[model samples]
Target: SSAVTKNTKIVLNLESLGSLPADEAGPLARYASTIQAQRHDYNGKVLSIRAEDLKSLAIIYDMSPDELTTRLIEWGVLSPGADVASYFDDE
Candidate 1:
């Protein structure tokens, strides 16, 4: 099935993951700290969300797959790369 390979991987920005703003992001949100800066300006974290699951999440949020993908990148949940974003998009 096409599901076996598409939208398989996405990198997350560790710094932004836990700091998603509450007012903007709702339940999974918290205040981000700016005082404790990363030693090497690091935000690297890799998390591969299963394609089906991501698709399901997008559906629940009433957002198109592309929109959700873009939002994830914006929120630092996904790496910022147009190529990466579209690589796994549903056909």
Candidate 2:
């Protein structure tokens, strides 16, 4: 039997996040600070977010994880198609 692998992480580009407006970048930077250990510098290409982090970050934006992912893409925090790890149930 074959098992499917579910992706539970999303990678972000710090430089891109830094370029955003203060109001937008503030929350991301604050969240990034808390996940120092999870952070990858040269980096999952940038900020590597786990499932838990994804949920938490969504809270900061008053969004659901799905919405946050879209917003992240819009903010350039996440690269359009390449950076995202498809969100799947953590179970």
Candidate 3:
């Protein structure tokens, strides 16, 4: 028998969620809500998360706007070509 070794682990930094003000409600908040929603609807599918969702996701993931966007895309949270930083910059 052969032993298997772990390949990779992505660390989620809860601290990243701290940047957004608790009271600040918007796209970011939506993102957080969306994440929870998707988790409940897990079916190995990609869903459209708005810019707000992106922001919220970033906070939830403890990542910068750019970082969160990239990860979210990788995780099937958003479609490609969607710029998370641009969304925040628009606000």
Residue lDDT tens for model 1, 3-90: 4434446544555666777665552222112212423323435334345555655675678767877787778777655334454444
Candidate 2: misplaced stretches above 4 Å? 1-5, 37-45, 82-91
Candidate 3, residues 51-85, lDDT tens digits: the string is 55445556766778778667545644444544445
Full-model lDDT for every candidate? 0.53, 0.68, 0.48
lDDT at position 14, candidate 3: 28
- The deviation in Å at residue 66 for candidate 2 is 0.8
lDDT of 1 at 34: 26
Candidate 3: residue pairs that collide:
16-62, 17-59, 27-52, 28-56, 31-53
**TM-scores across all candidates?**
0.54, 0.70, 0.40
Weakest 10 consecutive residues of candidate 1 by summed lDDT = 27-36
Error of 1 at 39 (Å): 29
Q: Between the candidate structures 2 and 3, which one is better when assessed by TM-score?
A: 2
Error of 2 at 44 (Å): 8.2
Best by lDDT: 2
Best by TM-score: 2
State the lDDT of candidate 2 residue by residue for 1-91, as single tens digits. Answer: 2122244357778788767888877988877766765444444447666777777777888987778888888887776764333453333
Q: What is candidate 3's local distance difference test score?
A: 0.48
Stretches of candidate 1 off by over 4 Å are: 1-8, 23-45, 82-90
RMSD of each: 8.0, 4.1, 12.3
